[model samples]
Target: MQRKKLSHQVRVSTEDSELFRQSVTGARPLMQDKIAPVSKPGKKKARQAVNLSQNEQQLFFFSDGYEGFVSNSASLSYVQPGDDPHLAGRLKRAEFQPQVVLDLHGLTQQQAKTELAGLLAYCQQQQFNCACVIHGKGLGILARKVPNWLIQHPNVRAFHTAPKSWGKHGALLLLLKINQPELALR
Candidate 1:
């Protein structure tokens, strides 16, 4: 059976319209208290007073300093002059236990650089000689850039690939030089 549908229309009366208008017009805005503006977090003050070039500052702020392919293999060892020969061997053999471990697996380039800088600074302040960084073997971004960053750090003496048990090519063992002035006071 076919049924006819009826449409209903809503209409506002003049009194209701007048009342709504009056209500709207009579309502006052809520009072708002003034709030002090919050200051954004500023860049951390450098531990040392040395001035950095504009390029260097930009490097720290923007990139991890890895421009392109690194020449060395991840397994290759490194030892700076005046450093113990056994240090490289020890790092390769996983001899010196790492007091701190920083993992940069999922971090972006900038984040990894910032964290690496902070960790190295903390390690230096605490007089820690050895630390481990797990950069992973993703697109080789961190693996390549982390080494470059470590090289730029003043306290970093040498760094080498971790052994098989300690993450192999994906991690590095860092040897940090103690701050001479701080050491002299001890």
Candidate 2:
């Protein structure tokens, strides 16, 4: 490597050097010490098997029973019977922005299910109106399974294939049920 020299060298005059030394005549020397960064360990929650909801548990209960056949490229969508028919349309149009997103790109089916449960549960817990689930991968297995599994979640009001801006065919936009519990009568 070639070193570039300064265009002009700076030289301090003897009078200027004497004035600098006089300015800090009584300064104390600083102690040389190095501090090792200490990071506190976070509280670890108990590691236990994730308990699936009754509807979710049924996924494992049925042996080739039926989840309704869905073609790989078909648009996955649904709105609960009593819900506003337009709710699904809103999702289709990407009107409501997803507040939280869960991506299942690299997860296995079982792992995806557990993570999906957590995402939905969190949405309900936080009373989120919309959430997105991205399941993009080489195969469309997750794309088909996620929507079918969502159809059974009670807290889900409606769901539709996400808009192009939201992952298009590789994702789903969810309209979750907002729960507001009454603390007491004022």
Candidate 3:
């Protein structure tokens, strides 16, 4: 026995087609103004777009010791050995107020390192328990570098990404080691 192939065609009514067209037209914007044409290319601007000033360039030139580190992930975190196990959780909860805040936005790597070192020194001298560093989530350079720098700093006991209200992944909450005097008092 031989089997025969069957074919079928579907059609829409003229009214249905007209209604669909009208719906699309009605949903479109009524304004028909043409966009202004882009100006013809003129003499090419300088290829090197250096936005940094002399001082900023100097700072960038001084960046050293950050050669081998790469950004691991957006949700990076760290806690020193023997530090409070709950430190990361509390940071996530925003339980502690930042005694000092450093915004490292728009700074080159060296500039940021210098500022961070100064901030840590200041916090250590003042015996601050916590500080917040807002390192924006730009190209992740700072994000990666900050963690590595913090790991090397003697004062940082723990650090983690800030909570939602505290700049989230773009910021870090650092728990500084208590001063010897303060520890003795306790």
Best candidate, TM-score? 2
Against the true structure, what is each candidate's TM-score? 0.59, 0.64, 0.59
Per-residue lDDT over 1-186 for candidate 3, one digit per residue giving the tens place of the 0 to 100 score = 996665765689999999999888848567968898999878877633223343343234333674533446666577777888888778777788899999999999877887777677667667898999999999988887888788766667888888877789899999888776634655
RMSD vs true structure, all candidates: 9.1, 8.6, 15.9
Q: What is the lDDT of residue 148 in candidate 1?
A: 71
For candidate 2, list the clashing residue pairs, or say none: none
Candidate 1, 12-79: lDDT as tens digits: 99999999898899678888788989999999877542223432443463344445325455475667
Model 1 steric clash pairs: none
Give candidate 1 regions above 4 Å deviation. Answer: 1-69, 72-74, 180-186
TM-score of 3: 0.59
lDDT of 1 at 112: 80
Whose lDDT is higher: candidate 2's or candidate 3's? 2
Ten-residue stretch with the least lDDT total in model 1: 49-58
Q: How does residue 185 of candidate 1 score in lDDT?
A: 50
